[model samples]
Target chain A: MDIATQTETAPPPPPPATTEQQRASRGATRPGDRIFLGLSRGSGIVLLVIMAAIAAFLTYRAALALSDNTGNFLTTFEWDANAIPPKFGIAVLAFGTVVSSIIALVIAVPVAVGIALFISHYAPRKLAVPIAYVIDLLAAVPSIVYGLWGALVVAPNLTGFYSWLDTVLGWTGIFEYQGGAPRSLMTVGILLAIMILPIITNVSREVFLQAPKMHEEAALALGATRWEVIRMSVLPFGRSGIISASMLGLGRALGETIAVATVLSPTFLISASLLDPGGGTFAQNIASKFNEASEYGRDALIASGLVLFLITLLVNGAARMIIARRKEYSGANA
Target chain B: MSTTAPTAQAVTPDTLHAARLPRWTSPLVAIGSAAAAVGIGLAAGLHSRVQWGLIAAVLFVIASYVLATAVEGRRQAKDRFATSMIWVTFLLAVIPLASLIWETVERGSKVFSPYFLSHSMGVVADQDPGGGINHAIIGTLQQVALASLIAVPIGLLTAIYLVEYGRGKLAKAVTFFVDVMTGIPSIVAGLFVLSFWILILGFDFSGWAGAMALSILMMPVVVRSTEEMLKLVPNELREASLALGVPKWRTILKVVLPTAIGGITTGVMLAVARIAGETAPVLLLVWVNPFINTNPFDGAQGSLPLYIYQQYAAGSEASYDRAWAAALALIGFIMILNLVARGIARWKAPKTGR
Candidate 1:
C-alpha cells in the first residue's frame, strides 16, 4: 500500500523537448568547451573508422579468395585453398562450429542457471558472497590455460565416458566412438561448456539477486512454499536476463579459438558423428592453418573469419537490444 | 473423587499448533540418502567416482522430495528438490575450477624458482627444458604496456563523448559499432593485422604487430567500462564547476576526471588482464621465437601464452614442467591484476553509486 501511494503521488519526468530546451539554455558556450567537445567527438569517429576498416579489409581479402575459386564458396567441402586451382569452402566449418556451439549451449545453460540460483537463493548468506567471487576469478582464468587443461586432462578423462555414450547410443551414429582418442567435437563442446559456465553463472546470479523482493515476499505471505514463490516471482522476472546472458556465452563459444584448436584434431571433412576425430571451426581453422598457409589460403581463412565475425556481431547485438528494451519498459513502469 | 474428575477436566489440551518434523530430521534424511547412494553404487560396481557422485545427487534430490512431501507438502517437497539440484550443480562447477588451479599449482611449484624467473630460454633445448619465462615476461610486459598506452586515451575520449556530449545518430552508431567490435575474434584481429601490416606492407613478424591486434581488442573493453564509470560522476559537480565560471575543459579535467579516475584505472587494469593472456593474436602476429629479442619492430618475440603452447607441444617431462610453471606464472599475474582492480573498485566506490 505504501508503494502504491508513493507511485500514485509521484510526478512523471518532463518530456524530452522541454528538457532539451532547458539543457540548451544552460549549456556552456565557450572556446574551451568547443575544443574539448571536438576532441572527444573525433575520438568517437576514430573508433567508427576502425570498425569500418576492419570490415572493409576482411571483405576485400575474402572477395579476393572467392573470385579465383572455381569451387562453390558456401557449399563445397574441400579446403585446398593454396593449390593451383585453390578450391575451398566453409560447409564443414560452418556445420561443426554451429553444432559444437549449440551443444555447448545446451549443456551449459541449465547447469549455469542452477548454480546461479543456488548462489542467489539457496546458499547461506556467508557462503554466497565468496562463491560469487570465486566464480568471478574463474571467469578471468586465461583461455590458453583452459586449452592446456582441456587437451591434457579433460580429453583423456572423457575417453571412458565417450565409450559409454557410444555403447549406449551407438545406433544413433553420432555418438559412435572408434576407440581413438577423444579429440572430437563432443570433447571441445564439453570443454567450452566448462570455460563459459562462470560467465553465464555470474550474469544470471546478478539478475536473480535483483528479483524484486516485494513480489517474492507477497508470494511467501500467501502461504506459498519456497519453490512456489520462486516460480511465481523470480523466474518470470529473470527470463529475459537469462536469455541475454546465454546469448553472450554463445557468442564467446562461437569465437573461441585456442580451446577448440587445442582440443580437436582438425581435418577438412564433415562427419555426422561428433565423436569422430575430424572437425574444424572457423577460428580454430584460421589459427591452425595461418602459419602454414599460402597467401591464397590466408585469404580463404579470412573469408571464414568474416562469417564468424558476422555471427558473433548478430548475437551480441541481439543481447544488447533485449537488455535495452527491458530497461525502457522497466523505466516506464517505474 | 468428584474433585479429581473436575481437575482432570480443567486440564484441557492445547491443539492449535500443527505437528511438524524436528530440525534433526532433515540431516538424518541426508545421511540416509548418502548411505543408500553408496550402497547402490557399490552393489552396481560403478567404476568411476563421477558415476557414484551423479547417483548420489539424483538419490538425494528424490529422497528429499519424497520425505518433504510426506512430512510437509507438495510445494515444500519441490523446493527441497530444487535446492538439492542447485547444490549438485554448484559442486559440479567448482570441481573443474579447483582441479585446474590445484593441478597447475601442484606441478608448477616443482620447477618454479628465482633462477627460473631470471634466465631466458636462449641456452635451453626443447627437450632439456631448464629454461625460464624471463624472455616471455619481457615480451608480454612490453607488448601489453604498449597496447595499453595506445588504447587507453582513445578509449577514454570515446567514453567521454558518449557520456557527456552524445546526442543523436552518430553516437548511437559509435555505440553499436563498439559492441560489434567487442565480439571480434582475436584470431580475426590477428588476421587483419597480418594482412594490412605484414602481407600488404611487407613488414616482418614482430611484437608491434601483436600489440596492434591486442590494442584493437583492448579498446572496446576499455570504452564500455570507462563509459559506465564516467556516467557515475554526478552532474551536480559539473554544474557547480560551470557555475564558478571555470572553463568546461578545465572543469572536466580537474573535477570530472579526478572523480572517475579510480574506476577508470580499475577498468584499464581489467582490460590489461584480458589482453595479457591473449594467445591467438600473439601466435599469429608475433611468430614465437624461443630466444629473447628486445626489439618490438625488428623480429619475432616470445610471449607467456605462446611459451605455454610451445612447451606443451614439445611433449616431454621437462617441457611439461616448464609449461605448467609458465602457466602458473601467467595465472598469478592475471589474478593479481583482477584482485587489485576489484580492490580499487570496492575502495573507491562513489558514495551514491551503490
Candidate 2:
C-alpha cells in the first residue's frame, strides 16, 4: 500500500537537518515566538504580583495589632481581646495547635503507613484499587461533616474510654482524665487523626507503589520473607514520603476549625494532661469567638490567624524541602 | 562431579521440604501453647469471665490456623489470613461511611417529601419546626453560585496567567501567597470577609458577605485545580494552534479551553462543593433567618449549613430533626454534583488510541 511505502521511506528523510534549515529560513524576533515567550514570562510575573499584594495586605493589618502590644507576641498566655489597651498573645493557642497536631501525626502516621503498605504491597490489584478509591472518598468527605460526626458521635463515645485511660494510665499525667464527660484534648486529637488519615494514606500509598519493583524482587530472591522484603525495599524508599505525608497531615490539623471547635471544650488554659480539656487552638478559638468579638477583639484574633498562617507555611515549607532532598536520594532527574 | 551433584541434591531435599512446609505452623503452635499457659494463669491476674473470653478467642484462632495449615499448607493459609486482614480493613472503612449515610437518610426521610422541597420555613415557627429548608436551600444555591461566579473567573484567570504567562518574581510571589491562602483556616476567611466588607465597606449581614468569605476559601482550590488541568493541556496542542496562526490568547481561549474544559468543569464543581458545605464562614458573614432572602446584595439569608448549625446548636428535639434533614439535603446535593461531574467527564473525555 502507499501508506506502507511512506512509512518505509519516512526514516530515510533528513528530518534532523530540516530544523536547521527552518532556523535559517526564519530570522530571529519572529512575532509568534516573541508572543509565546512574552505570555509565558508574563504569567510568572503576575503570580508574583498577586502574592506580594496578599502579603502586603496581611502585614499591614497585622502591624496594626502588633504595634502597641505590651507582652511578647509569642509567649504570653492571656488573650485579652476586650481590654481597653488590648493585650493578646498566642502561647496557649500555639501550644494547643502543636500538641493536637503532634498527637494527630503520632496516631495517624503509623496507621496510615500500615494502610498504605497493605494497599501497595499486600492487596490484590482489584482489591487495592477499590480500597484506594474508598480512601479518596474519605478524603473528599466535608470537614463540616467530620465536625458534626465528631460532635455527635465521637465526643459522646469518649467518656468510657477516658475513664478507662484514667484508671489504667493514671500515673501518666498525659492520659489522666479529670472527669470531664465529653470534651478533652485527647478527643480533639483523635478527631484530627481521623480527619487527616486519608491524606497521609493517599500520599504514602502512591509513594510506596512507586518503589522500584526490582529492589523488592532482589530482596525476595535473597531468601528474605515477604514482610522482610517490604521492610527493606519499600520502607526505606518511602521514608521521605512518610515524613511529607505526616507534615501535610500536621498542616491540616493545625488549621482545622469546625471539628475542633465543635468538639473541644476550650477554657484558655494549657495542661499537661490531654484529658484535662482546657486549651484553645488558634483556629478553634478564632472560629468559636470571632463572631462575637469587638473591633480590638477581631484584631487580636487576626494576630492569632497570622501565627497559624506562619506555622502552616513553615510546615509545608519543611515538607517541600524534604521532598526536594528525597528527589536527590532517588536520583529523580526531575 | 555428577555423583557428587546427586549426593548434594539428595541432602538438600530434606531441608527444601522443611522450608516448603507451613511457616505458620510454628507460630500457631507457639500461640496455642502460650494461650494454654495464659488460661492456667488467668485466675491470678484477671477476672474469670474476661480472661475466659480472651483465652477462648486465642485458642479458636490458633486452632483455625493449625487446621488451615494442616489441610492447605503454610503458603495457602498465610495467603488466606493476609487476604482476610485486607477484607477486615476494607470493612472497617466502609462501616463508618455506610452508617453515616444510612443514619442521615433514615432520620431525614421523614421530611423528604415533595412538599418539603417546595415549601419554605415561611409557614413554620421556631418551636413548630415541622416545615422544610426552602429558605436555607435557596440561600445555599444563590450564595454559593455567587461565590462561584466571583471565585471561578478570578481563580481560572490567575491560573491561566500562572501557567501561560507568569514567570519571574511576580509568579514566584503569587505562588507563595496562593500556598498561604490554601492553608488559611475557613474561620479566617470568614473574619477577613467580615472585617473588610462589614466594618470597612459598611455592609451588614448580606449574603454578599457570605459569598466573599466562600470565595476566599474557594479561590485557592480553583486555582490549584485549574493550574493542574491547564498544565495537562499538552504543549503540542498549543504549538499546533500557534502553527495555524492563532493568537496566543485566542489559542488559550478557543483551543486550550476546549481541550481542558472537562477537567476545568470538574475542578470548578469540586471547588463549589468544597465551599457549599462550609458553616463557619457563612455563620460569621451572614445573619441567620428562617425566611428566604433571594437577594445576595440585601438582607440576612439562611443557608443549609448555617441552618444545620443553628438547629443542632438549639438542641431542641424538633429542631434536631430539621438539622438532620438539612444535613441530608446538603449531602444529597454534594453527591448529585459529584455524580454529574463524573458523568460529564466521562461523556466529554477525548477519544484516543484505536
Q: Write the per-residue lDDT of candidate 2 for residues A138-187, one digit (tens) a residue.
A: 66666666666777766776676677788999898888886855677778
Badly placed stretches (over 4 Å) of model 1 are A1-29, A332-334, B1-20
Q: Looking at model 1 chain B, which ten-residue stretch has the lowest summed lDDT?
A: B12-21
Chain A TM-score relative to the true structure, per candidate: 0.89, 0.87
TM-scores of chain B alone in all candidate structures, in the order given? 0.92, 0.79
Candidate 1 lDDT, B1-354, residue by residue in tens? 778977776696445644456778768877777788789889998788888777767777787788788876776778778777788788888998999999889988889999888888888997995889899998999899989988998999899889877889999999988877887888888888887888778899999999999999999999999999988998888878867767767878898888988899999999999999999999889998878888888799999998998888788899889988999999999999999998999888765534
Clashing pairs in 1: none
Candidate 2 on B134-238: residue-level lDDT in tens?
888889999999999978877887788788767677675666666656666677677666656775567888888899889877887888878887888877787
Task: Go through the candidates in order and give each one's C-alpha lDDT.
Answer: 0.86, 0.74
